[model samples]
Target: MTRIFNFSPGPAALPEPVLKQAQQELLNFRGLGVSVMEISHRGKEFMDVAEQAEADFRDLLQLPDNYHVFFMQGGASLQFSMVPLNLLGEKSTADYLNTGNWSTAAIKEARRLCDVNVVASSEDTNFDRIPALDTWKLSKDAAYLHITGNETIGGVEFHEYPDLGTTPLVSDMSSTLLSRPLDVEKFGVIYAGAQKNLGPAGMTIVVVRDDLVGLARANTPRLLDYQVYADSGSMANTPPTFAWYLCGLVFKWIKSLGGLTAMAEINSRKAKKLYAAIDESNYFTCPVAEADRSWMNIPFTLADAGRDGEFLELAKARGLLNLKGHRSVGGMRASIYNAVPEAAVDALIEFLREFEKREA
Candidate 1:
């Protein structure tokens, strides 16, 4: 079977090795008679798988002892509600950076739970850039400061994280997590939906500092409470076993390739190549600012809107799939997550060149 290069934003692509390994083990996981999906989450076999996945992830991040990792259900959208429901102890407001679609969604959810103070926003710029750090109107007493590490749809990212003294820094790193090494100690909370850089669509990986737990308001649902996951090791409910197992395989794959440091080097090279191609070509244009461009997601527009359909159809014919941009922002987007290899980027760059030549 042949695999085409995929660029969908979420439920993106999985490493071929990981997929093959899962396929081999699907019928009878590691000599067990039943599929991992049918096994009990609390059973020793699945428990071991869950524990090792967290351990490898911690090793990848060099996570500190003070932080607890939980594999929860859904994507980071659940964390949008959980973050404010839990972190906003007695504070009336939380600070948020409005970068793009995910950031706006998080801010809207927080507003329902507490007063949301937008620290900075790039709305006036049509979300083409990150609001300069100096322009942020921060609150010293805010519960926590929130930022989307990367904007999947808009293709903007915070290349450098903000330094907030005393206040906890929170991030929705769904699109950027595990793409490179991160300073785990710099933030009180980090949550990632397990589709882009992780394994699958059904699980989310949440890393929260010890202090951030046990503070959910009395009215918060038990399942929505971070404390419950922490207390029960994310087995308070039946977890997504297959997704968790696949995530473990992915973590191992990353480790086998020499961990996040190596992964970062490869990802940087891939993104640099693609961005350089976009910048050098008059036939294409990247809408985001140079400094704020995302290494994981690259959105570019053809010279005109009329060529979009031809561009997409030709791309598909040439084995490049899902290059269509989000409907909100019309154009083309390429989500080069961890599973996407440098060769894919090279292929994309070559396609862009040929397509532009044909248009010219």
Candidate 2:
């Protein structure tokens, strides 16, 4: 079998060792004689798995005692509505930073439930750079200030967290979570879809400062309330048992690899290699500003836009797959998530060189 490297954005690559471990335990998990999927979520064994997963995650992030971590369903997109439903209260005004497609989608959702204040935006600059926080005009009485830490479509990122003055800060970190170390105390809530750096698509990890819970709107559904999930330990329903188990495996895998600090170092090296290749090549160009470029997702375009199809075809033929960029941004993207080995980036660089030579 050919060794293929997957560069998909989400439902992306996972560590081979984790896959192997799951395969080994598929029939019988830890002598339970049943797959983890078949086990009861409330059973002692699964409960232990859930607890340990949260503990490892907290340890990895150094989460404070005041913070509550909930592994819930509904991707980050769900949080767009839930954020306002749970945090907006009678306060109908919230602040949002519009960076790209995802951030815009978040803003649109918030508008349905509240009066959204677009604090700052890169739309004027074609979403090529994150607007400096110093230039933002935040509302004095806003309920919460929201930002998407990494804009997957634009390949733009906020390398440093923003300060929202006195307002509570919230972030959609779907692409950047677990890619590096973060100060959990800086924000009121941080949520990420599991498909990127976490595990699979069915789970979403939400970390909320304990004090922010219980602020849900009067009509908010029980399942959409942060405090409800917090109070119930994120098992309000059956939950995605298999995805939760896989996330546990991923968290363990990350710990065995020396935690987030070491992972950050590896991530930096991988991104540098790919970005350096783009920067040095006249045939290729990455439009995002250096300070705002995403380490996990890099979007670039060829000198000859007409040859986009040719580039993808050749790349796919060479075992490098899913290099296509999002439809909103018609270019090529290389998502070097945690599971994507550095060797894969090297292989991609080699292929880029070959493609450039042939095209030139």
Candidate 2 C-alpha lDDT tens digits along 1-360: 656899999989998888999999999999989999998999999999899999999988999999999999989999999999989877989999999999999999999999999988989888999898788888878999999989887889877886655688999999999999998788999999999999999999999988789999767788999988988999889899999989999999999999999999999999999999999998999999999899999999999989999999999988899999999888899999999999999999999999999987
Residue-pair clashes per prediction, in order, are 0, 0
In candidate 2, which residue ranges exceed 4 Å CA deviation? none
- TM accuracy, model 2: 0.98
**Residue by residue across 1-360, what tens digits does model 1's lDDT show?**
799999889899999999999889889887998889988998999999999999999999999899999999968999999999899988899999999999999999988988889989999999999999999999878999999999999999877887888899999999999999999888999999999999999999999999999988898899999999999999999999899999999999999999999999999999999999999999999999999999999999989999999999998998899999999999999999999988889999999999888878
Q: All candidates' TM-scores?
A: 0.99, 0.98
Off by over 4 Å in 1: none
Candidate 2: clashing pairs of residues: none
